[model samples]
Target: MSFSRIKRACAVALFCLTLSATQINAQQKRTKGCLTECQPRIGIVSAFGGEAEVLLAETINKQEYVINGNLYTTGILRGNHVVIVLTGISIENATMVTQLTIDHFNIHHLLLSGIAGGVNPDYKVGDVLIPRRWAQPLEVYWSANSNVPAPCGTPRDLSCLGLKLSRFTSQPNSDYQIPTPNGPVGTGLFMRDTFVRNNSNFPNGEFKFDYAADPEMYAVAQTIAPKLDRCGPKNPSLCVAVQPRIRRGGRGISGPAFLANPDYRRYVFKTIRAVSVDMETTAFAHVAYANEIPFIAFRSLSDLAGGDDFTDVSALFASGLAESNSSRVTLGFLEAWSQKYPE
Candidate 1:
């Protein structure tokens, strides 16, 4: 071959190689962008390690990512794509991790599964309750005592006390007799609605107590009412008196405190009309609402909050059953969800 022809052929080959390299780089950038923007997996969050043990064990193709000291395991769970994570065990922890999960991953829906104290007497140990909505009832004002001329009744009337109910014209408690949202959960603690920002809908926000779960997701949960496992594998002898059932809808409340008092439980059941009470649901709900993502919580009743007239079973005794029950329902819900959102 001629020297000029050989040199020209080499230059042509180099041009083709550069063109291929440029195309590959462009494709890589596009792939990276899609991964960051188009996340369609369900986010399954638990409050503690034990609560998520069953789900974590069952997850297939698990790949873990630790961000800011929080562990997130991404995998396919029960035929649906999901990312499972433990958000610690408090309202603050829940809020922080939920937002973190939302921020870091492309989450289409957020589902929280864990054990909660059954506020309503109707629900017993091992029963699962998926609340229609969740709220933080601990947003209260610790008011100063208003000395109202000697005896202020045995319980000390909240009206007589100097506690103020924000955004409420009349209290929702027995003394007021007015149907309202805000009320005094305790003597000095006056409950009020939480004010949250509109993260996506910038410069606009609302003041409300109840943050509702996704209607479609809630409906799917309601469809599956299978009997839950009443006994744990570790202790076959220890079983709940009644076969566990799943209840959907009604109010669910969350707060910073772990409620174990009978009188307070009665007040929560009667005044708040909450079906379940936990430490993290409302925080997750709040973040889900702010970020405008579909959200739901599956809370298995570990024990009756306050243990009023019921079998005084500690949460410790029922924790295994409750966690199992919650995870079962979560799997059911995810299975149903796959039908609607198959990817």
Candidate 2:
């Protein structure tokens, strides 16, 4: 071939290579954008003490850490996944850490893990309670007399409120349900946070809680869901859904948190119906769900709420077992999630 002809051929090949490079660069830019904007970032929230510490320590990359008063340790677990721990058990404190994690880390998925108490009679010591809805406490006040109304607001019949009632019920405990096209739905699996110990330990050695409503973690989910999913991928955008169960490995014992209840007997059952009676999971669930970050809780039943009148504190420390159960469930859930979201 002539030298001029050869030069022309070389020019054509160069042009094709340039075009290919440009296309590849464009695709890389798009992928990075998705990671920053589209892909769901996950997080975990749990209290410092009790079963939460154990479960968190084992699953998370052990690098002992603390936030505020809450102690936590985090690191890579499964491939690209990362886990975070909250410092303490208070709803306000846990919520604070959760918010910080989402904002600072750009995390989109959040999970609440820990142990909780059983309220339903059907739930055994080892049985779990996946909170379906968080119940909100009615504004109440003492009546000067029986006929007169109480101080806060009159207790209006809330059952007719429909979805609102469900929302309220979930708000207190921090366990939330999303209102989807197909009615309200909870997270697929029951993540245990509360536990029971013995067969005979509640009312008349048979466990029971009074029916009175209050607040817990679902309140956080209700408060934050709108804030998180405002702009993201997943078409309809993701919302928070929580289901907290129990780990029964714990000895039947109640903590000071439960003991602090003014009318423990009357309100315990009522509070369970309205909110997450167990402490830790709701905090994690609420923060992740409300912020539009994806999260799922996996807790274990560690304590029976009724044994020894729920007075023993040491028995409630089934931290090791709780962590073990959470690890198994979380890994399984994540594996399934990867199949659905094969990014």
Best by TM-score: 1
CA lDDT of each prediction against the hidden true structure:
0.75, 0.40
- What TM-scores do the predictions have? 0.77, 0.48
Please count the clashing residue pairs in each candidate, in the order shown: 0, 59
Q: Which stretches of candidate 2 lie over 4 Å from their true place?
A: 1-40, 48-74, 136-276, 280-290, 306-319
lDDT of 2 by residue, 45-107 (tens): 655354354445445445544445545455554443555565466556666777766554546
Q: After best superposition, candidate 2 residue 5: deviation in angstroms?
A: 54
Residue 4 in model 2: shift from native, Å?
55
Q: What is the C-alpha RMSD of each candidate to the true structure, in Å?
A: 10.8, 18.7
Model 2 C-alpha lDDT versus the unseen true structure:
0.40
